[model samples]
Every structure is written in structure tokens, then in C-alpha cells.
Target: MRGRNIKKAAYPYILWTALFVIAPMFLVMANAFSAADGSFTTANFARAFEPIYLAVMWRSVELAAVCTAICLLLGYPAAYFIARLRLKSRGALLFLVIVPMWMNFLLRTYAWLTILEKNGVINSALEFLGLPKLNLLYNSGAVVLGMVYNFLPFMILPLYTVLEKTDGTLVEAAQDLGASRAGVFFRVTLPLSLPGVLSGVTMVFMPAVTTFVESNLLGGNHFILIGNLIEQQFLTVYDWRFGSALSVILMLIILISMGAAELAGGAGEET
Candidate 1:
């Protein structure tokens, strides 16, 4: 009676989730194998493997990997500082991390557009100081910069969550045992903090890889990532089948990464 009662109320919510979330995903998967005569076929998956599309997918992976690495380098210090701060100031530091996310993502992207434009603020400042103007916009550098700027909070928040809960006594214990400050960090703190690191990497990377808007606006559509390509196929080219295939491929890649992250976390815990 108790178990039956327990499932009674929860079953509808599960039904709703499966109907909304799982249904769409299954439809997309079905679309991946869709045919002109409305019969199931593997042709779409075969078509998705073409060199041009594969290159676009690969480019997206490469860019996301590089941007995630940069976020780790920059965000680790920021998260660490926030973690080490006194209790009263920690809230302020977290607010700083959060405030940017509340701002419109498009507005943030547009702000970079202004700064990176040829005769914009940066160039104007350079000219005022008798320095050469830089051509920075519409390049891979700009794409990465915009991505890092937007996704930084995602990295810091996850890392900070882990770091804030860290045991300071362990770090101090390392230092008292003839270990240098750097050694204590690398040996003790870092090993313990891998969950946060993994969380940050996954958070920054998936969105960065799949973000079409930043690349379109900042990179000037000169470069194409998988997101941009998928957008073009669905909206511009009117190829839902191909686009669905791309979406499935992208989803699968994300799933694989998430699974790996879970495995990594489990492995860390085991060791």
C-alpha cells in the first residue's frame, strides 16, 4: 500500500517529462532516420558523415576545447580567490560572478562588437595614445574572447561551490609537513577539487561549442562551427532532416562528454 501510494502522485510528473523531453528527442532521432516516402532509413546518418559537415563538427570541438582550457586557466584563480575570502566578502564575490549572467547575453556580445570594431573604443584609444590600431574583430580570437567572457561565470560558480566547502585544515596540514605552498596546492587542494574542475569544464565547453550567436555576431559569420551550420541547415537552407541529423550528432557528443565526466568523478572518488 505504501509503495503504491508513493508512485501514485509521482507518476504523472514522470509522464509529463517523458512526453515533453523524451518525446521530442525520440522524434528527432526518428527524423534522423526519416525518408522521403516517410519510411525509416539510415541515409540521413550516412549523409551527415560527409566531409564538409564533419569538418564543421570538428571545428566546433576544437574551438570549444581551446575556450574551455582558457576558462580553466582564468577561472581557477578567480574561484580560488572567492573560496579563500572571508565569509562576509564571499557573498560580494559571488554577486560579481552572478551579475554578468543577469545581463543580456546579446548586449554583452554587442559590447565586445563595439570595442573590437575598427574605429571603435579600443582603436580610438590606441590612436589617442599614438599606438597602432589592432584588427581584432571578425577573427577566431574574437570568437574565443566572446565565449570566454560569457561563459566565465559558469566555470567560476561550479569551481567555487567545490572550493568553498574545502577543508582548510588539510591545506594547512600539508604546509606544516615541509610541503611548500605550491606543493600543497598541487598535491592536496587540486586533487581534492577535481569535481569542481570537471563541472566547470563541462559547463563552459558544451555551450561554447554549440553557441551560434557569438560566432555569428563576433566572428562575422566568416567562421562556421557546428551550431552555425545546424542553424543554417534548419532555418536558411530548409533541410530539417539534415539539421536533425546534426542535432542528434551534437547531442550524442554532449552525452559522451557528460558520461566521461561522470566516470571521471567516480574514478576520482575510488582513488
Candidate 2:
């Protein structure tokens, strides 16, 4: 009776997943494999592999990779620093890092426009300093900047969590064995933090690769990533079959990347 009741309680969640998640995926797959007249086809996938679309895919991966690397480099240090701080100070700094995320994501991305526009804050500062105003908005750099600003905390939080839980005794033992600071860090601290690093990389890279808003708002029409291509297919071109194919391809890329990251993380842990 108790087990039946427990199963009954789970029915709502199961139904919700089926309705929202599974049903949409099924529709996308059905559309991807169907032609305009509803006949089965593989042409959509083939078309997505054309050089033009492939270029967009490559650009998306490249930008996402750069964003992930930047976040890792910047976040690792910040997380390590915070992990070593006194409890109260650490909490305060972490709160500050998280506060920006509490704002609407669109609002945060829009806020960059005021800072990066030709007649915006940075240019205004430059003008005040008798320097040339830079054309900072609507470029690849601006897109990257927006990605880094938004996704940085995702990288930092995981790293901080892992570093905070790291055993101090390992560090002490490494030092007692006469390891240099760099050696201790590289040999002990870094290896133990691999899980967090992998988690953060996955979290940041997935969204960064598929993001349309930052690229649209910051990159303008001059720069088009895979996400933009997909959006254009669905909304502008009204080609659901092609759009569904692109979505499936993107999903496969993310899944494969995640599997690779997991394998790499496991190998690091074993080593």
C-alpha cells in the first residue's frame, strides 16, 4: 500500500516529463526525419552538413571553446582565492558573484549594450581621457565578453565547492615531502579539482554554444553562429524539418562533448 502511494505521488512528475520533454523531442525527431509532404527523408541532415552551415557550426564551437577556456582560467584563480579566505569573507564575496545572476538574463545581456556601444560608458570614459572612442559593440569580442560575464559564475561556483572540500592534509603532506608550491598545487590541488573543472566546463560550454541572444545582441548580423542559423531556420525561414535536424545535431554534439569530458575527468581522477 505504501509503495503504491509512493508510485502514485510520482505520477504527476512522470506525466509532466512526458508531456513537456519527451513529447517535444518526439515532435522534433519526427519533423527532422520527415519531408514537406510527411514522407520520411534524410536530406535535412545532409543539407546541414553543407559548407555554409558547417562554418556556422565551427564558429559556434570555436567561440564556446574560447569562452570555456577564459572562464576556467579566470574562475579557477578566483575560486581558489575565495576558498582560502576566512568563512565570513568567503561568503560575502560569493554573494557578490551570485548577485548579478539574480537579475533577469536578458536584462544583464542588455546592460552590456550601454557599456559597449560607440557612445557608451567605455567610450565616454575614453573621450573624457582625451582618447579615441572605440567601436566595441556588435563584434565577436563583444559576444565573447557577454558570454564570459554571464557564464563565469557557473565556472567559479563548482570550483569553489570542490576546492573548499579538498583535504588540507594532502597539501601539508606534499609540503612535508619538500614539494615546491607549484608542485604541490599542480600535483595535488589541481588534480583533485578536476571534477569541478569538468563540471564547470560542461555547464558553461553547453549554453554558450547554443546561445542566440548574446550573439544576436552583441554580434549583430555580421556574425552568425550555429544557434543563430537554427533560429533563422525555425522562425525566419519557417523550415521546421531543417531546424529540427540542426537541433538534433546540436544535441548530439553536446552529448558527445559531455561524454568526453566525463571520460577525461575520470582519467584525471585515476591518475
Candidate 3:
């Protein structure tokens, strides 16, 4: 009976690990390691380090990092507000934070396209206000905005979880000990919330860097992220070998980011 229960408990995790993580990763490695001669080769990865791909890759890292910073700056305030709320209103505020996530992601990007385009609602509104018309669409700024907008909830929710459950007595004790507000936040609240911040940062940055639709639609395909490069290699260029290599490289970047998050989390926990 105990054995059967143990198996049942482990079943879902095993299935998810295999289906979502293992299988897809194996496919990527297989494609990346195999060559055009149908033989094993590291040449595919060698191709990935070429200047053009590296440039796009660096751009992706920069973009994701910038978006992550924006999310943290904007989300931290909302989370702090929600954390300070009375219990009755907390649920409502959280609901508002998460509701947008229920809408289709692509649909949200499309909405941005309409609002930001030349002579669109914003431009018209500016014209009506007798302001200079701004052509804001189809640029890197719009892409960053879309990514930050889409992923903001992810940034907020984790931090909210950590901050909401924090020990109030510790905070009070710090205040009683004469720690200033900023000192308390930097020393107590911020450190205490590091787990959630790490989670939120990881949740925002990794996917933000890899988004294809936002850059394609809102960015006007003028800026090509690593995700966009991979898409081109597969769909437009029809070069699965190079695409697989790019995929492998992209995975490495995410892995590195996640590893750094984990290390930071561990260090914070140790403190």
C-alpha cells in the first residue's frame, strides 16, 4: 500500500519532467549535435558563434535585461502597495493584477499595434491636442513596452507572495531598533523578498528575451532578437541545422540566467 501511494505521488512529477523538459531538450541537442552529413558534429554550435548571430544574441540579452529592470521598477511598487493593503482588499488587488494574463498574449500585442501605429489612436489624440504627431510604432521601444506589459504580472505575483507572508514582527522590531524606512527596506524587507524577486526576475527576463510575436508585430521586424533569429532560421531560411544550433545556444543563455538566479537565491538565503 505504501509503495502504491508513493508511486501515485511521484507520477505527475515524473510525467511532467519527461514530457515538458526532457523530450524537448533531447530533440534540441540531437538537432544541434548532428551535421548535414548525417554524422555527429560540433560544427553546428561553431556556426552559432558567428558575428551576426552573436550580435543578435547580445541584443536579446540587453533587451531582456532592460525589460526585467523596468518590470522590477514598476512591479515592486504595485507589490508593495498590495502588501500594505488590508486583508479584504488584497484579493481584489491581486485579481486585478492577474486578470490581464487570462487574455491571449498575441491579442494583447495586436492591440498595442493599433494604438501605437502612425496615425493611430495615440497619433490622432496628439493631433487633436495640437501636439506633434509621434510615430512610435515599429521600433525597439514599442517592443520593450509590449514585453514589459505582458510580463509585468509575472514580476508582481511572486514578489507579492514573498512580501505578503513576511514576518511583520521582524519589521516592527527593526523599526523599534531605530532603522530608517529605507534602511529597513534595504536590509530587512528586500533581503526577505529576494526569493520572490529572483523568481520574478527569472520569470520576466528569460521569456522576454525570447519573445517572437511582440518584436515581429510591435517591433516591425526591424529589430531581430535571438528568438527572431531562430524563427528565421527555421521558417524563412529553412535551415533546421542552424536553427537547432541557435536553439541550443538560446537554451544555454536561459540556463546561465537561471543558474545565476539560483546562486543569488542561495547566497541571499545564507545571509
Separate clash counts for every candidate: 0, 0, 0
Query: Candidate 2's residue-wise lDDT over 133-200, tens digit each?
Result: 89899888999999999999999999999999999999999999999999999999999999999999
Winner on TM-score between 2 and 3 is: 2
What TM-scores do the predictions have? 0.91, 0.96, 0.94
Candidate 3 ranges beyond 4 A from true positions: none
lDDT of model 2, residue 203: 90
lDDT of 1 by residue, 1-271 (tens): 9999998989999999999999998888887788867898888889879998888888888889899999999999999998998998999989988998888999999999999999999999999999999998998899999999999999999999998888989988999997898999988888898999999999999999899988999889678889998899889998778888899999988888789888988898787
Q: Name the lDDT value of residue 164 in candidate 1.
A: 88
What local distance difference test score does each model get?
0.90, 0.95, 0.91
Q: Best-fitting candidate, measured by lDDT?
A: 2
Candidate 1, residue 152: CA error in Å?
Answer: 0.6
Residue 4 alpha-carbon offset, candidate 1, angstroms: 7.8
